[model samples]
Target: MLILYTYSFAHMFKTSSFLMISSTEIGKYIRNMGMVCFVCSLLLIIFPTCGYAAINTSSTLSIGHTLSSPNDFYELGFFSPNNSRNLYVGIWFKNVDPRVAVWVANRDTPVTTSTANLTLRSNGSLILVDGKQDAIWSAGEAFTSNKCHAELLDTGNFVVIDDVSRTNIWQSFENLGNTMLPQSSVAYDIPGGKNRVLTSWKNDTDPSPGEFTLEITPQVPPQGLIRRGSVPYWRGGPWANTRFSGIPGIDASYVSPFTVVQDVEKGTASFSYSQLRNYKLSYVTLTSEGKMKILWSDGKNWTLHFEAPSSSCDLYGACGPFGLCLRTSTPKCVCLKGFVPKFDDEWKKGNWTSGCVRRTQLSCQANSSTKTYGRDTDVFYRMTNVKTPDLHQLVSFMNDKQCYEGCLGNCSCTAFAYISGIGCLVWNGELVDTVQYLTNGEVLSIRLASSELAGSSRTKIVVGITVSLSIFVILVFAAYMFWRYRAKQKEPTLGVVDTSQDAWKNDFAPREISGINFVEMHTIRTATDDFSSSNKLGQGGFGPVYKGKLPDGKEIAVKRLSSSSGQGTEEFRNEITLISKLQHRNLVKLLGCCVKGEEKLLIYEFLENKSLDVFLFDPTLKFEIDWQMRFNIIQGIARGLLYLHRDSRLRVIHRDLKVSNILLDEKMIPKISDFGLARMFQGTHFQDNTRRVVGTLGYMSPEYAWSGVFSEKSDIYSFGVLLLEIISGEKISRFIYGE
Candidate 1:
């Protein structure tokens, strides 16, 4: 409509001019036409969103113009930072308030004029052009004549893509600003010295790099670090299995799951997080005050989830080397047990940066005689509930004992800590950034000279003797009470009516079972530490399984049946009879069974890797098993089923088959277990009917679940469900009908 009006006015003016109109009238008419055209041009530039979101060589995004993300979550064009009038081509959250800019294309080179524009050059480079049309900033890709375009992704990554190849050549994520959105990362290349760090703005109003930076250090078992210029400001500690050792706050309840990807060969590591929930907008920002703050917004306002350098003790090397920082203590910093202040006057003045030095030099450091320089020359003083110090070297050792031995063998080893998920970590140099926690902390053992240990040994001996006597008296009283109670009550035998000794025996005689051994109940009780709760692995339909180690150093899984278990003597007998006869590699080898009165136990070879459900369902562990591993597991399970149904002498039907019942060995070989619900098939038998259903839900066939009609096909149906689970990495119950 505006264009039509302008054209008509131009035509009428030309006609009026030709018809000899008055000079003043012609001038007024020309002024009116110019005002109308200017208004139309301004409207076109202000409202350019006519369902298109792209800019080519011919197009330019001016000061008032904008280019939105495909999902409209982010917008990229021109923005003024804080209170600065200097314009910058940046990306900011569309839904967030106060216009939180995540990425700035020209943070340091801000355009001074409103006529500044963002343009995509024909050479396939995105450039920020000033009023003079001079390029201020460009996406420094090699000049290419190929068709290419720049796009703002919903993930807040601005990318320059090669349209012909549909591949991103450059991205803003690789050059992170102060804020790290979901899927954005802080990457470090140790070998190449290339780092994508989160450097704080000079201040709230400034977008330039500040003194503080958050980056992943290029250390063995790489860790996240916050540095102030060239010095360390805060340390995030080494990455443990699930989280960073120093940051205990990142746990199961955290809003977003933190992930660290490390490539040892490539010498690179990256820290990132996934947006598991949609309502919450989470980002980690490095504040100008040298604090790394993790904040999230839920539509209304931003909430601070966590912040590093949260306490005085969190400051990097707050207590210096060989000094422990305990927030609960009045002074906060103290010298280690075997060490004294290097400079007593400085320490008294609260200047602990001068750390502490060993009071008695290590025997290894002294030129002592060979006999005197033995293991007795030094002892380890155990410090419990403490965060292990920085600059640790990870060593290969099986257990805490081996870790201690390995450290003792090294003369330069200063201290060692054995973490549960992460094994032996030893430090050869000064222990810095040590902090004490109230609970759930690793134990660090500092090596002390024999002279220092001798003073404490006498005290330890006296206390040990006192405690031992007290424990002995208590045990005697407890044993007497147990004996008296047992004497007063009748011993309950197996609930079976038969009272003969043979009643405990199954179809296979003890002598006939060649490989299986009938273990004593006393041994199992000893191995499991008298059924300690700590030793319990998990609970099954029948009973709880406990992890135990035999006297011969063989680990075993003891499945003890509870008195209140749904499966009674029938199931027990069936399991012992069926498993004893089966000898396939994929089948869990039945080491032995114990039938001592009311106590019934099934012993199986302990698989170090535990069950399939553990790795299959765990978010952190699921990546360990790739597609090839899953395929191998599926094939192993199929072979085991084939052996049970067709190959074995006795045809068997496993009524329950699920991820939890599938045990993985040390080598990750799958083994089928839990035969309490298994039934044997007679000759030529194809199917059987029962009034009661006996299998886990979801995996059960429709006919078996509804009508209690089960056969070999029922087991096959369960396998099919298991196969789907292995491929999709989801539980059968979670699978929707249509999906």
Candidate 2:
């Protein structure tokens, strides 16, 4: 049953060199060499007993002989299971421990004895017949008149073919069951159900099909699901044009990359990967415990690298329909906005199956007279950072805006989300199997009755108004008290910033100031609308930045550093001392400064354009910067680096030069911002080495990324990487897979 064999003997060498080898050793070697059994015997004629034999096979089935595939990596043979009288034709890795079985020819009807036979027919099919002359198993329907061949490939794929046509008629990979090795699939032919699927074993001791199965569903979004009987246990959420959102926190740890496809004309979906090293072996399998696991071989044994449904949130409907599962909390169910517990008492008792109900009745049900009555009363609530719900209707041949309008125009739509590269997906019924994500995914907008929305809006407006009135009252009272006190006192330190005085008195004494006055908290609160969430730009180690416009219509970015934020304070001081002294179009300009109680703020002239990463790394924005613009960005970054290293007065080294720190002006000019990590070198100092490294990976130079040594040359190496990034539009860490 063995397809091929490999044998080497020392007798051939002994005879050719006229060196004597023991006669008994020669006979033993000849008998052990199965492929060239007679060749060894023939060599024994002239060389005495000093001969050996090696073997290879094309298409041969015998009582004892077997086939070791082309690369001799695996062997196909009839073997009995552990503690079983039944025999089976199975393929196992050659010379490896655990003797892992990739495929079984007669898993259900195993051979009862050693006399069981398996053969490759003249027709392209392979058949296994037991000692009782009972048909145990058979391969695909393939036929031939005179020429048929079977071979085992290095990938461990066994194939039956025709010698004349030389086309593979049958392969083990296409009939996969429980195990999915690299290149082997649970689903094969995309448009056809020639799709391979894996069914778990009936039990630990039985290889018969079990209740659990794993396969890809050719649904709109094309999701992979694991089911127990007909019920779905876990789902690899709809592939987000890029990857599955449900499986969060995927880094470079696993070497596998997955792909999904859906075509009405050619319905297909699949996933596959490549090994990091040649010697390592890996595969994905549906374990008996009803879990999908990715296992890899590390020479000695297989290792489990990843698994789906690894947490409670991974279970389908674990939190019930219309409920969100938050893994970070106890009793993980949370109602969506505008929804309340269906059974408050049951929910209090920790029974979440009742799920949630709309807090307000739908306006459509209240009125039937006019069509516009219900249409205008339905509002959409933005749901961010979520793993979108299931059972979707795919709408193709439209852009995001078109999809949005299409869904918005329909009254039956409950929620809708449009993804790039993959058209629109809309859900109309109850949203089920939804989980909140800590990582940023796509957004989903849920439809709610106007009453629910108005309540939410009213609450926000009331909070805003109350805060505004309180601030106004406090300011008026303070102003009155200050005027009366100033009238009575000879000297006053009341209003800190004023042209009447040349300096302000600090706790340490008097300090001269030329920058704009430290604006009162009330003025800033009014100008930036109390640092409202709507006006907020971004939050960092410093508190947050807000987009503020002066009374004169000048826009500015306010960086409000916190009192306890030592890092932010240092960054602020560094930026002020370094950038404020320089005047360059490629540097962020400091428009003014503010010092309030426990708040240190710096105002910079707001560029119409934002940070470089916002555009350059964005999927939609990347296309806007064509080759010409990308090249310009590269050259501009190089110029900025040259200025920092050579043109600047202090010969500064921008230790951090990531896309995030690079800002753009209206003309698309690149400005280097954030000097927190920048280091100034004394005259003629070429380089410096430190024990601590403070730069992003991929962009960090080899010498600097590995160690804390840096210089102008280090910056040059980093620039080279930046140049390549701009040219190829790929991250450095992703360079390994040609990402």
Candidate 3:
């Protein structure tokens, strides 16, 4: 019996170790085995993690427990909403800020306790059940789930599909909530003529539907409108030739790839956003304030990429019908040229809700019987830089010319404008919600009375006839006198003079030149804000340069020649005459010139990157000009010289080519500027001489320095010095004479 007891003790010890069972922990190990198997079978219910077993629909998961993906990129289980003890089945970003919740199975109906068991049934449907064994939420089987599997894609879209066919059964995009992810549409597909829309959240915390809705209208030129409680709040304008006119800022700002799908046959449109870069998180959200905004996240909080209702012009009919709104103006609304405020007193008191009325009443259809007396013909007035009115009709089978002709042939056609990229859009009713943009891209023609047209035409005709008669009489008298005095003259004085003689005869006169559109003094003053101190961008010996944006949204740098400045009006005129005709990629475009009321303003394309000196001189900005950009500057100067000296119609010499004269655009493209001291050469001219030894001291060549001789070669020498300066990042003047 003692030997038998010893054998039993050793055997018990060996068995205990194999089962991982100790005297006190035997119960714990047995219980742990059951729990491990339970977790292994339940892995399919929770987000995938390193510790969880690989599971498919065959495995089931329950609440009071969880499962993770193999790579730990996802986790799935029962979750409770904030402040709500009830549990929910949801999927969220495992590694993200704010822990973005992508999909919610039971949002409205939450399970009361931890008794909710989330299971992937054998039939391939995900089922969430309560402790009472009641199905809380189920992936309803509208179609066969014979081979179905649910996958949480890396793009944050939960897609349920048939495993064998790889056919998607249902997607998260079909039932969008508040946030619109990239490639998702906010507008809805109408089912049985009932639209399904992505409504805004009641607040950031609540995902319930809100009061606002966005949809595309079936108007003439179909447009997108946002409504609040069935009242139009914002209109994205009718689609112009290319895009919606109301969203011009989008075209200018966005660099990302995007597309808008419009189906006329299906009568549906969808805006889609995509990115080649994975890190760019793009999304669109309609705010509680009823503003539609497109946003992007960069691993942190969301940034506003584009937003509508951004300006006063975006407000629906803020200026009323027949009224144009200028945000920069005092009252923001003004009656169109031929119209007056309907209520003058109220309009003056900042109340323009009544809008404007025609100054002259329509008389076209007044007397149909009498086509002469009371039957005043209708006429259309040219309105430039005007935004076309809303509520248009799209007419097919008509080009721009045909569209205009169709409108012109009709007596009732009020206004018309053709968009090349979008086709023809016309409005026949009251013009409403019109606003002038700084970058006005539309040209509208408004109808008027024939009497008004005839009155203006008669005055112009009389003035023209009078001027022509005076010129004709003067020519007749000059011909008679020249013919009588030809015998006494050296050559035939009435005919064309030789090129050499013509140059000498007109040397003293302010030469007449063409191709330059002259901006009036008043217009220049308005652009520069009356030479306001605030508009001053920079100052030099020529004058203080002011930055101004024209009515058409083209930014310009105006060089307002100061009275006491060394460069006089004649020098300014010379520069304008020469530079206007010269066009080169490296040369800054001279838009127009103004010489009136003692105000000489030269309008040039604005360069946002500023001059080379602005970047090259300052230590903080100098690093921006790397080897590549500096090399571009060098090559650009070479190409510009090639054009001016050899390629251009007139052989030109830009006598001044300095760092300050080189302007940089927003893209860092170099533009050789400042033709104030420029000289033009005629014929096959290789060289020319100038009496004035004008130019910066350091840039002057030795030959040009001693002698008052200059040519295209002199300009080349200066360009070489500028090239070295750009490379070394040092000004020649500063290098030569210490400052």
Predicted structure with the largest TM-score when compared to the true one: 2
Question: What lDDT score is found at residue 418 in candidate 2?
Answer: 70
What stretches of model 1 exceed 4 Å from their correct place? 1-46, 49-52, 251-256, 276-280, 329-331, 366-374, 451-739
In model 3, the Cα lDDT at residue 254 comes to 22
- Candidate 2 lDDT over 556-581, as tens digits, reads 88888765545654566566566644
Give TM-scores for every candidate, taking all chains together and pairing residue i with residue i: 0.59, 0.60, 0.56
lDDT for 373 (candidate 1): 54
Model 1 residue 665 lDDT? 90
* Residue 76 accuracy (lDDT) in model 2: 70
Model 2 C-alpha lDDT versus the unseen true structure: 0.67
Instruction: Estimate every model's Cα lDDT from 0 to 1.
Output: 0.80, 0.67, 0.67
Please give the ranking of all candidate structures by TM-score, highest first, separated by commas.
Answer: 2, 1, 3
User: Which residue runs does candidate 2 get wrong by more than 4 Å?
Assistant: 1-37, 40-66, 78-86, 188-194, 251-256, 276-279, 329-331, 364-375, 396-402, 420-423, 456-739
Task: Return the top candidate by lDDT.
Answer: 1
